[model samples]
Every structure is written in C-alpha cells, then in structure tokens.
Target: MLAWTGGGVTLLGLVMLLVLAASRGWFSPVARLVAGAVLGLALLGLAVWLHRKESARAGAVAVAGTGVAALYLVVASGTAQYHYLPAAVGLVLGLVVAAGGLGLADHWRSPALAIGAVVGAGLLMPVVTEGWGPLLAALTVVLEIVAGIVALRRGWPWLLVVGAAWAVLYASLAAGVAGSAELWPAGAAAAAVLVVGCALALYALVTSSTNAPAYGVLASAAVPMLVMGGRLDGWRGAAVAGGAAVVMLGVALVPRLDRPVRIVALTVGAVALLEATGLLFSGDVAVAVIVGEGIGFAVAAALLRSRPTLLFAAGFGVMGVLGALALPLPPGVLAGYPASPFTRGGLLQTGPLVTGLIVAVLTVGLAVAMLVALARTGLLGSGDGRAAMWVVTGLVGLYGLTGFVVGLALLVSPDRGGFVAGHAVVTVLWTVLALVLLARGIRNTPLRVAGLVLVAAAVAKLILFDLVSLDGLARVGAFLGAGLVLLFAGVRYARLVSEAETATGPATPPTGVAAPAGGAEQAAGDDGRGTWGPPDART
Candidate 1:
C-alpha cells in the first residue's frame, strides 16, 4: 500500500512540477525542452536500474515519470509548424521507456508501466494535432494498436485497458469534429479507430487465457463505436457498427474459442444487432427484425444448450411483442374502419387497423413457431429451453386470445355499448378456457397448475374490477355465471381428490403377525390344559 501511494505521489508531483514550470515563464521553451528531455532520460535510466534491483513499484513509477516528462518536453518544444516531429519524438521516448521496463525480469515488469506509457504517448496525438480531427483520430488509433500489440506480447493486460480508453476518447473527439464541420473524412477515421479497437479486442480475447481484459477491450471499443456511429450517420453508421459486432460474434463462435469469450461475444453482438434494428427500422418492420433475431438465438441456444443465450432469446422475443403492441395503426385505417376504438370524431381510418391486425397476427405466429421449434428440437429436457418454450407459448397464447377478442369487438360492434358488451363476453370466454385448462390438468399436472392460476385470475378480476364497473344485465349475468362456474369447479375438484385418494386403498397388517395375548389363538392353545386341570378332578 505504501509503495503504491508513494508511486502515485511521485508521478503526480512530477506532472504538477512540469505544469507549473510551463505555466510560469521560468525557462525558455528551448531550455525547457532540453531540460525535460534530460529529466525523461534520467528517469528511464533509474527505471531500468530499479527494475533490475527487483523494485517493481519504483520501476513502474520511474517509467511513468519518464513518459510524462517526454510528453511535457514535446508540448514545450514550440514547433507549431513541425508539431508532428515532437509528437513522434515523444512517442518514441514512451516506447523506449516501455521497452526498458519490458527488458527487466518478468516479475519486475509492472503492467502499470505499460499502461502509463501507452496513455502518455496516445494522449499527445490530439494535443500535437491542435484538436480532434481526422489526423489525430488516425494517429491515436495506430498508437493504440501498437500499444495493444506490445501489451499482448508482454502479457500486460492493463495496457489493453489503456488502449481501450484511448479508443473511446478518440472516438468521442472524432465524432465531435464530424458534428461541428463538414469533414466527411473524420467519420471514416472514427470508423477506422473502431475497427482497429475491435480487432485488438478480438486478438486479446483469442490470445489471452483470461476473459476480464478482453471484456474491457470489447466494451470500450464496441459500446463507443455503437454510440458514435449512431450519432454520426444514423442508420447507415448503425449498420456498420452492427456488422462489426456480428463479426465479433462470428469470431467467438470459432470451435476453439473459450466458453466465456463466446458468451461475451454473443451477448454483445445480439445487443448491437437489436439496437441497430431499432435504429434502422420502425413499427412492424422493427418488430419483425427482433422476432427473427430472437428465434435465431433460440435455435442456437437449443443447439448449444446454453442458458444465458436462451434467456437473451426470451428477452428479445418479449421485446418484439412489446414493439408489436406499441405500433400504431395508420390514421387512414382508423379513417376507414369507423368502428375501430381508435377512430374518433367520425374520422374513420383503415390502413392502421389492418396493419396492426396483420402485425399482431404475425407476432403470434412467430411466437408459436419458436415454441414449436423448441419442442421439436427436444430442448425441453434442459431447464432453460423449457422455460423459454413456456414463455413463448404463454405470450403467443395470451396475445392471440386478446387480439381475437378485440378483432371480434371491432367487427361486431360499431358503438361503445357494443364494444363493452363484447368485452364482457370475452371475459366469459376466458373463464370457459380456464375451465378447459382445469379439466385438462386432471390428466397433466402442468396444465392443472396453469388452469388454477388462470381461474384465480378470472375470479379476482370479476370480484375486483368487473363487478364494480359492470352494470344492469351485464352485472347480474356476470355474477350469476361466475358463481355457477365456481360451484361447478369446487364440486369437480373435490370429486377428483376423493377418487385419487380412494384408488390407493387402505393399509393392512402383515399376514405373519401373532395374535394378542389372551386372544382366540392363545386361549385355544391354553384352554385344553386349563379344562384338563378341572378334568383331572372329574377323572
């Protein structure tokens, strides 16, 4: 702890000193540049010595101090016209210091030293280039890629993290530059940075035995790319980013890839694709895309027997359903379909209602298809697959049933009163379906449990909402009908339970068991002797 604190303080003090010196006109720019270079070299020498002497923390501090001094020197050089030269010199110095640290014994090569060097050098590109634009963005990407390669070779995972951070920063700056000006090239540069970062991340995942560092790289690259792409180019940029993410998923699916790597890649890819779909499409089209992707995921999960993927598939499937439900029917459809609940002020429409009905039907059909696929794939043996199957089944069943009732209401009823009556009838239909489920449950436990839950829900609705809102004949019929149904259900349930208990028969004693003392057998066995004792007197 003390070593870490001291190292931190030393690095901070050096930076502050340089900033103070630069702020105050303590030295000429030429003199300051020369002095900074001298100090940076001296720190590099000290780092090498400390590393050899097995002081890893001190060595890391010195290496970081060297990079900072190099950066300060480059900034102080005052070569505005030749700014790239200074940047190059500072980058080289950072590499030299990093190389010196790497040359040390493995135990003494701190990842912090590599991270510091990469960060120091990578951050100088923007400053040297004056501000974020195509040139700076390009340089930063190249620098990060180089740093990543070095980190991979030296087994310094922290350097990969530094590279990822630089990637995010560069991406943000490039996006800002693109937004402020008509620089079409800046967007391309940002895209290049994203690609490089993703590649480095994939390399890290492939080469490194652990997953933690790979995840850092992926999030840093993939997430920022996604955000920047969407912000800059809208759908076009989103498609590009989504494609990159899909590439990562493909890499993850390699036969030799680690399980954790594959899982992370799959999750990131799935989310990116879904986000892209949301950005690129709307209404029923978006829902269709989501449903298709969800079904694909479910199929993959079934094949791989992966729970996490199955859950993700289920989540996406639900999102599709929600999207479908939220979609608006066209105003023209409402204009034509005068009886539609959505139609108001006598402005009937047709397109939206038809479109909505079609979307709902398609959504239900897709859900049913997914359930059937899962079942046919024989995935029910796995807990995850079974859960997913049931989730899709329930969603499709409920949505289909609701849509049917609504469509009937719209078709049969042209007025508000008729719509209300239609809903009341639907409630009765629900109750009848619940009863069917209950009857089926007598043969299947799962069906029985589902039936019970549905019946309970119906009862709750009748007592809580329907009873209070309904009036006139509707109210009377609802109560009377619910009461009769409850009575019948209770009677049937009792009979079923009684029959089940009776079929097992009663318990009986073992056949070899002896009679109790003074019972018939024992009395019979002793009676001859007792009677004979009285017979002895008789004889």
Candidate 2:
C-alpha cells in the first residue's frame, strides 16, 4: 500500500510539476532539464518502492513512469530554446539523479533507466544555454562533459556519445571559439570540436542499443545544426549538408528500427518541407543553400533506402525542390516557380527544360534506388498497410513523371490520341491502387477516412480523363468499373468504421501494436539487447 501510494504520488507530482512549469512560463529548455531531472527522481523512487512491495505491478508502474518522464522531457526540449541556463541545470541535475537513482535502486538499475538518464542529460544542455551566458554557464558545460564521461564509463547506452558532443560544443564556445556558419572551421579548436560532435552523433546513431535513444540524439542535433546553418548562411549551409550526409551514411550502418519507422519518416518529411519552403536561407546566401540542397538530396537519396529510408528520401525530395526553386530564371512566370528560360527571349531560352530534364533523370534514378531498397526490406509484400500506402504513392509519382515526359513528347507531335492513352493508363493504375488502399484502410480508421476522400478525388480524375472522350463501349466499361470500385469501397468503409468503434469499445485495449505480417522479426532481435520491449516487459 505504501509503495502504491508512493507511486501514485510520484506520478501526480510529475504531472503537476510540468503543468506548473508551463503555467509559470518555464516552458523553455532549462525548464525541461529541471523537469526531466525531477521526474526521473520521482520515478526512481516509485520504481524502488513498488519493487519492494508490489512486485507484480512493479514492472508496469516503473515502465510507465519512466516512459512518461522521457516523453515529457522530449516534448519540453523540442519546444524550448537551447540557450536557457535553467534548462541546462535541470539536465545536469537530472542526469546525476538518474545515474544515482539507477545505481542505487535495485529495481531501477535496468538498462532503460540508465539510458534515459544519459539521453535526458544530453538533451538538457541546449535547453540551458546555447554555449554562451554568464559564469554558471561555463560550469554547466564542464559538468555536462564530466557527466557524459561518467555515464559512458558506466555503460549508459548513448550517454557518452550524446553527452560528449554537447559537452565539447559547450567547452569550445566557452573557450571563445568562433566560426563562420557556412564552413566547417579549418581552425584547430573549432574543427576538433566539430569533428568530435560529428563522431559522437554518428556513434550514437550507429551503436546505440535502440532506435529511441538514437532518434532523440539525432533529432536534437539536427535542430541546432539547421538553426545555426540558417543564421550563418554560407559555410554553415555546407557544414549542415556535410553533417546530414554523415548522419545518412551512419544510418546505413545501424540496425533497422525495431518499431515502425514512422518517427524518422516524419522527421524527414518535416525537414523536407522546411527546405522546400526556402526556410533554409535569407539573402544571396540562398544560392549556396540551393546548391547544397541539390547535392544533399541527390546524395542522401543515393544512400539510405529501406523501410527506414523514408526519412532520407523525403529530405532529398525537399532539397531537390528547393534547389530547383533556387535556379536562376526570369523574375516572372508561375506564382511559386521561376520563369522558364524561354521568357528571356534568348536562343537558350529552353535552358530550364534541359536543366530540368537532367535533374529529373537524376531524381528518378535516386527514386528507383529507394524503391529497390524498400523492395529488399520486403516492405512491398509485408502487407503493412502503411508501407503499402507509401509504395502506392511512390508508384503514382513515377507514373506521373513518366506521363509528364510523354506529354512533353506528344506536345511536339500534337498527338491527341497518344495523350489520351497516357492518361488512361495512369487513371487505370490509380484506380486499382486506390481500391487496394481502401481495403487496407479497413484496419486503419484514419486511413479509412482518407481513403474515402481519395476515392472521390480519383473518380473525378477518371471522369475527366476517360469519360469526356470515350464514345462507345469503352466509356461504359470505364464508368462501370469505377462505379463498382467506389460502391464497394463505400460499403467496406462503413463496415470498418463500425468495427473500429466496437474494437475500441470499453473492455478492449487500443490495437496500437499491429506489427507487420512477418511477426516482428526486428523485435525478436531486441530481447536481451537492453531495449524497452512492449509495455508489459519494458526493460
């Protein structure tokens, strides 16, 4: 009873502390460090107490508490800036507490606890101060370095790596280090620090026991880098590109994500969006940004290519778009696109076409490589609906590109029938993929809704593509096929929605663990690998 009470109080304390912190305007990184430390302490105490009295419930309570604490810290860090001392202090204190807590509490010495402590500490530094501030700032830097060493020596999963990087960056800044953002410093001190941080980040990404820790470290590292690159402009862009390239290479050296590769994919997608929107630059620096993005995307796409490869592919796509946007052209044309070279009224007015064709070929080649990688993972046949969706979208993109090329060719020949044929083929393929997607949606409620919307859109597209010109039996056949597909999909969607509600009804737990059809080959490898398993057997 005492253990249960302690666990309950600790859990409540964590929620209240964060709520209070946010309410009090301490939503910065410093607050996160402090909050994480406090939460880790509370969880440690609860885990210890529970183990002594509530043995059967201990694992559940401990895992839940630890996860909650880690998640809260991740959220806080993401929202907060890195230059706040309070957050850094929280990080250091939390690391110490976690290290001590895990070491002292028999029940809490599990690898998950140790890893959380290290990763939590590494994330806290930027939360505290951005390598500059007052006297306490210097101490924070030194302490983080020391803490990282301790954590590393004690086998704290990714601690030594992430911690070391954070510490060296702080130490360099404290030692009056300065470098133009556009370039990796050629100076001894700055270069050393850069190299060390790169090494550490790569080490964590490649050697960490689990993707969770690697994700946190890499995600956090990417933030400051892009921000710094954005501010510095020239060499910074180059450095950022180089760093990202290194990370992409390192990702190939690591094991695949045991869980769904969703997080990495989302991160890639977000970065791609940022790059595509020109958020990567300010002035003439935009030129360098474009060049770097082009190279980066081409290189990244050529590298990472698997189920986990989604992140790099997305990032590359963004870079490709941004680079295209950066190409020099007339000041007028499409709203977002630069004018075609033809508008300049020169003999080489078709320069964009030639350049675009070259870029297209390169991009297509990389996309094909990505497809091959995904195929190797067997993700295409895995029946993992999400993978299926990704594959379908990829195929659509390929067909669309092919259609564009064919359309361009037909424009010169003025062959209306050929144009119709291209559209018809694409429309047919899309209809089939759409039906499959809708079927897959039966198990995924959100996808099911999206599928309905897509089906409607596809029907409209087919009407425009086929019905308008078809005058005979072909028109009837097209309408009949499309109508049957839509009707069947509608009926299937309705049934799935009803099933979803029932499946999520009171007595049933959410089906969050829908592993792909291969029976979780990756998770099986995680057994004894010091990773947190499903909620029931956390460590």
Candidate 3:
C-alpha cells in the first residue's frame, strides 16, 4: 500500500511539472528531460508495487505499462553516438523491459505496447552500429515493415504512424548509400514491402467502408515504394506503367460517386494524374495532363450547373483536342519527351504559337459559357450551404490560371516581335480578369483577396519577363504607368462598392427573390400561364 501510494504521488508530480514546464517555458528542455526521467521511474515503482500486492495477472499488466514508458526514456537519453557505451547499456535494458511488457500484452491491439517497444528500440539501432551502416539500415526497414503490417492487422493507429516515421528515416539513409555496394539488397527489400503493403492498402480501401484510414496506409506505403522503385530503371519502368493504368481507372470511376464525393474523389484522381504524368517526365504527358485537368473541370462544372451532358461532352471534347493539337507536335511522338510543345525552338518556334492560338480560342469559349451561367444565375447566394462561391472560385481559379499560362505562350506567335506583343496582351488580359474578380460582389473575402493577389502576381510576372529587355527609361515609365493604373482602378472600385452598400442597405436575406406561390396549382388550371405571387406568399 505504501509503495503504491508513493508511486502515485511521484507520477502525479512528474505529470504536473511536465505540464507546468511546457506552459511556462521555464527551463523547458531540462524540465522535460527531468520529467521524462521521473515519469519513467514512477512507472517502474508502480509496476513493482503491483507485482507485490495484486494477483499475478494484474501484475503483468502493470509491468508492461511501466516498461513501455521506461523504454522511451532510455532510448531518448542515448540519442548521441558519442555516449555509445551508455546508449548501448540503456538500449539493452530497455529492450529487456519491453520484452517483459510484450509478454504481458493481453490482446493483439492492446494499445500497441509491444510495437512501441520495438520502435523505441529501432531508434537506438543507428547509435549501436557505427561500422556496418547498411546492415543496420536494412534491419530498420524490416522492423518498420513488420510494425506496419502488424498495425494494419490489429488496427493500431500509432503503430502505423510510427512505421511511416521509420520508413522516412531509413529512406534518407538509403538515399545516401544507394550508389554504394549496398544498393541491390536494400532496393529488393523496398520493392517487396512496396508491393505487399500497397496491395494490402488497396484491398482495405475497396473492401472496407472506411476510406481515410485506407488512404493513410496506402500513401505511407506508396511514397517509399515510388522513391525506391524510381532508382531502379527496370522496376521503376514497370511500376510507372502500372501506376498509369490505376490512375486512368481512378479517373473513370469519379463520375460514379455522389455529387459531393464526386468532387472530392475527382480532386484525388487529379493527384494520381500528376503522379503518373510526372513520372513519365515527357513534355507531351505534362501538357496533356494539364489540358486534361482543365477540360475535366469544365465538364464537371457544366454537370453541376445542370447543363445538358451532351453540351459538356461536345464542348470540352473539342476543346481538349484543340488544346492538344495547338502545341507543335515534337518532330515525332518521342519528341514530346524531355521538352513540352510550348517551349520555343528559337525566337520563332512554330509549335508554341499554334498551340497558344488554339488555347486562346478555347479559353474565350469557356469564359463566355461561365459568364452566361453567372448572368443567368445572377449574384444571388446559394440557398443551400452544401455549395459555396468560394468552392467555385477555387475550382475555376485553378482551371483559369492553367489555361491562361498556355494561352499566353501560344499568343507569343512564333514571330520575333509577336512574342513580346503576345506576352503583353496576356498580362493585360490577366489583370482584367483579376479586376473582375475583385470588383464582382463576391461573398467570400478569401476568394476576393486571392483574386487581387493573383492580379499582382501577373503584374510582377509581366515586368520580369516582357519588360526586362527594355532600356532604363522605358522600363521605369511602364512600371510607373502600370502601378498608377492599378492603384486608381482599385480605389475607384472600392468606392463604388462602398456607395452601393450604403444605398442598397447592408446585405440582407434572400427572402426578396422567392419563387411564385401555388404556381403548380395555377399551371394545372385551364389557363396554362401561372399567376405570380409576392415573395412572402411563396413561402
């Protein structure tokens, strides 16, 4: 009883001091170290106390709980290699304590006590092996793999988190050692884990209703898999092909999701596109991916707005093809590799000019469609909170900016003087769009700020690229003129909005624009025309 009482008091003091140290920032590091030590010792004492007074079964639980804490303190203190002897002693003792704790774990998912022990032990592996780095490195990977697999099977969250951390640690070590004699074995181990882990992760997502956890597991496994495989040309080559197929399939499945999920799933699918195309590292693939994303977004927007699906199909389909054709096709399909079609061969690159023109036409079409949609819908806010203007801004902003870049490059018109003129026109168009976004009665403040900032970026890009070649006088004059124009326009726009708000009264509920009441009843009558009613009557 006395031992138990003393242990509880010590544990409470350590917990209190640790909290106080963190909150007050009073000798924080030292306080933390002392707290860790005291906590470990208190846990140890509690274990001993339990062994004496409790039934053997309860004693086992107590011992396991205490040992895990002690393990952390032991490994943490021995972080530096110069203290190798002390580190080894601490590591060995901690492992012994952890082994006893693992034996006491009553269930597979008993809060991951055994796995935690191994993780604490894994940290000390680097400190122990000064000479045989590769061997030690492989051991760490194996430990991480085993831990990750166990975590998935048992549904232990921390085990998965720790496993990812270890993978990163080992991957960094492997990167430096990859060119050396140790490369083949390390690569093989990584490949094995990648294939197995990824398969498990995909199975979890497809088979289980839970998605977030599945994704977390898959992402952790996939990143290292890509990194390790990328270094081996043969494996990297095969994996890249496989990844492309998966991404394509994922894209096709996006439309099947419910409306909200469709948005989220498509966004994730876009990431797969980036990954697949990025690894291919060809100019054509990059351009295709960017163009595809723009087209896909446009189609999704049309669908959301309840336009005829056929209209989207026809519009985006033609736009996608034209966007692709405008880029000067490399001398051959392979020419698309290394460099994109937008890049100029000389000051007079024909491909970029053609591509730019095609892009410009498509962008103008999209802008028109969007404007019509907005005008028809009016400046009214969404009655449904499920949708918001900011979401629209974000989606459209992504597509518009991407299209803008391609359009400008195309406008450069492979001719010498045309390049400068094209760039200037693009900058002016960008500034105009930015002004529209800022001046429009946007409900979302962040979206408004983003639009203004994007405009500023366009102005900066213009000065940096188009005017850099000009003489001192021309450059200064252009800068001053542009700055003054922006400032005056911004001020005028603000004043107008301010005045409009005052005259119209502060923003009000959408009750004024309610639909007609009993329209259905009137339409059913002999008169085909329905009688309109006041907004209040509609409700």
Candidate 4:
C-alpha cells in the first residue's frame, strides 16, 4: 500500500509540474519532453538498482514514471508548435525504459511496465496525427506487430493482449473514417494493415509457444477490419481478405501445429471465406458456397480424424440448408409470381416451394456424400465419433424430410386452410415416424432414444400448437389420434420385451450352487441330477 501511494504521489507531482510548465511557458516543448524522458529513464534505472531489495516499490515507481512521461510527450506533440518527431522519439524511449525494467529481479512486476508502455504508445498515435485515420491505423498496426514480437520473445503474454486491444480500437476508428471520399486512400491503407496484421498474427502463432491466446485475440480483432474493407472496396476488398484467410488456413494444416491452434485457424478461415463468398455471389450461388464449404470441412475432418471439426461441419451444413429455404428463387425463374408460397395457385408457381424442394434434394445428397466419405476413411471407429456421425445423419435427414413435407403441403393447399391442414399432416407424420423409430429401437438403443424424444415432441406440438389452432373436428381428431398412437407404442414395446424374456426360458442355478428340494420338481423336464436330459429319458 505504501509503495503504491508513493508511486501515485510521484505521478501526481510530475503531472502538476508539466501543467505548470505549460501554463507559465517556462520551457520549450522540445526541452520539456527531453527533460521528462531523461527523468523517466533515471527513475527506471533507480528502480532496477533497488529491484532486488524492494521489487514491488520498484515496479510501482517504474510504471508511474513511464506512464507520466509518455503522457507528457503525447500532450506536447498535440500542440501546434511541437513537431511530431520529438513526441515519437519520447514514446520510443519510454518503451525502451519499460522493456529494461523486465530485467529486474521480479517477474510479476514486468507485465505492468510492458502493458503500460504498449497502451501508452497506442494512445499517443491519434494525438500525434490529430486523428488522421490512415496514418494512425497504419502506425497502430506496426506498433502492435512490434509489441507482439517483443512480448513473444520476452514471454510477456499480457503485452500481447494490450496490443490486440489497441489493434481493434484503431481498426474500428479506421473503418469509421473510411466512409468519406476524401479518406478513400486511408481506407485502402487500413485494409492493407488489417491483412498485414493477420499475417503477422499467423506468423506468431506458428513460431511462438505461448502465443495461442494472442493469435486468437488478433484473429478476432482482424475480422471486423476485413468486413469493413470488403464493405468499402466491394469485391476487391473481399478478395484480399479471402486470400489472407485461405493462407491462414493453409498454414494451419501444417502437420506439426497443435490441434487447438489448427482448429482456431480453420474456423477463422471458414468465416472469412463465407463472408467473402457472400460479397462475391448472390441468391442460390451464395447458398451453394455455404454447402460446399460445409462438405469440404467435413471431408477435412474425416481426413484429419478430428471430431470437433466434424461437428462444426455438420452444424454449418444444417445452417446452409436453413438459409437455402429462406433464400429467394432466381428472378428469371419466378418472374411475375406472388412472393408468398401460400398465395400461389400451385407448387409450380410457388417460388419458395420449388426452392425448398431443390434445397432438400441437395441436402440429402450432401449428407449422403459426407457419410460415405467418413465411412470409407475409417474415421468413425470410436463410439463417440460414430454417435456424432449418426446424429449428423439424423439431423440432415430431418431437414430434408421437413422441407419436402412443407413444400408438398404448400403445393397441395394454397391458402390459410391449406397451411393449417399441412401442419396437421406434419403432426401425423411426426407421430408415425416416432412409432417406427421406437419399434426399431428394439434393436438399436440410439434409435430408441431418438424415437422417444420424437414422440414427446409430437405430443407437445399437438397440445401446444395444433390443439389451439385447429378447430372443431380437426382438434379432436389430432388429440385423439396422437393419444392412440402413443398408447400403441407403449403396448408394442412391452409385448416385445415380454416375448423375448419368455423365449429365453426359466432361469437355472449355476453348477456350483445347491438347488432347493422343490427346485427338482420344478425342473420336471430335466434329469434328477439337475442336468437337462431328453424328453424320453425324463419319462
């Protein structure tokens, strides 16, 4: 507490002296900056000298003095009379002094100095440039890259976090400033910095041991910049970002890289590719890109023997199918048509109806292809992996079946009445499917569990949705039909279990165990020695 208080008081005194000098015009801006830098350096040296004996005090003083000096330089450079070069020099000197403090006796105190130096330098960029977007963004990127390198080499992971935070801040500012015609060049420059920063982050990920968190942070920070660049430059910006993402993905494929790191890289790449594809295409083609990428990811997962990636691919594929359902059909194909499927006269005239069919067919084909590929690759050997594969298959099947049913319903009924009737049909379909699954579960546990869940869902839907929306006979029929089906399922399952047990016959004691006296009479078809014998021998 005392050490902190002393450092705080010292920092306050330095700030007061700087303000007094500026108010009274006691010294030139350059002279004051030089003096402050010198004083900060002297204090850092003293702190290092005392570090062994009083490490905490040394750290507090070092952080306070460095922060104060850097602030002075930033404020001075923002003045009309001072050149930007002197402030830049002072900022660099402060960073050097902070870096030197790491060599002191305590490892814990070094992060404070390192984070403060990087953050202080970052804060100075806008003041020095008077908020010029391009220059400030570029400088911030360069600073972050340098800081990342220093931090990685020095093993100060916190400094990487500070750098990543500043990178995001400056990238956002650059994106905001990019909206003006006068700042178009700045936008281009900012875009370039984003790409370069991503590359630098990738390199760090490859080379550094403790850089996993930093890589994730940097990649996350770069995504917005890439998006803004695409928005600014249209197709060209998207192409640039896409290329960088592909490169990152390629690097992630290196055999020696850690699995977690590779997964992160692949994820970032996939996202960037999707965003770029959206910029480059429209309608069905964009949807196709999603499906294609999903399939590709699944294949990669199979080849790499990665379960997590497989799950991701499965999820992505499902989303693509859903997106396809919502997407509009091509204008040429559905010209002069009512937009709503229910308003159309038939399935042929309904755009969404036709699109849904196409999407369903495509989803089924892709799911089949993924299953075949995974099976051929022998990737489903583990129980968990096999379970995941089954789940993916089930989800894909459900999506396709739902699409087909919905489309067919819209085709047959083109009004609200038709819509309600179609939902009722869907309810019946779910119930029947659940019964089939439950029967199949006699041989398969997973299928049985899935069947049970489906039955529960059908019941919930019948009560919650169909019961209220349906009227008169339809409501009564839905409730009655669902209840009967559930009852039948329960009876069938019990009968099968009973029959199986009966076929196995009565239980017998082990050879080492003595039987009760009445046990012999109960086994009338057996020998008197308690071993089963032919019927003729028993008679």
**Top of the candidates by TM-score:** 1
Candidate 4's TM-score reads 0.57
lDDT of 1: 0.59
Off by over 4 Å in 3: 1-109, 128-155, 180-219, 225-288, 294-348, 357-539
So what's the TM-score on candidate 2?
Answer: 0.39
lDDT (10s digit) by residue, model 3, range 52-167: 55464344343444455444433433333223235345435544444444444424235545554555445544533343233444444544455555556666546655655565
- Runs with alpha carbons beyond 4 Å of true place in candidate 2: 1-147, 156-194, 197-227, 251-305, 314-349, 359-367, 381-391, 394-539
| lDDT digits (tens) for residues 1-539 of candidate 2 | 45434544554455445445656776764565566566565655555555666554546444434544443343334333333436456445444444453444224444444444444434443432233422222333333344444444454645544454554454334333343541232122333333444444445444554534535434443443444335444544545544544553444434453333334533533453344335445432453344344344434434544444554455555555445445531122211112344234322234544444444454455455555554455444435575554455354344334434433433343344433444454455556656776778766654455455566666876666567754455456656667776677667767866887778752232366444332334434445453323534534
Order of all candidates by TM-score, from best down to worst? 1, 4, 3, 2
- The better-scoring model by lDDT among 1 and 3 is 1
- lDDT of all predictions: 0.59, 0.45, 0.47, 0.60
Considering every candidate listed, which one attains the maximal lDDT? Answer: 4
Model 2 weakest 10-residue run by lDDT = 329-338
> Higher-TM-score candidate among 1 and 4?
1
Per residue, candidate 4 scores C-alpha lDDT tens digits across 301-343 of: 6676766567667767876776665663222222122334424
| TM-score of each model, in listed order | 0.60, 0.39, 0.39, 0.57
Indicate the TM-score of model 1.
0.60
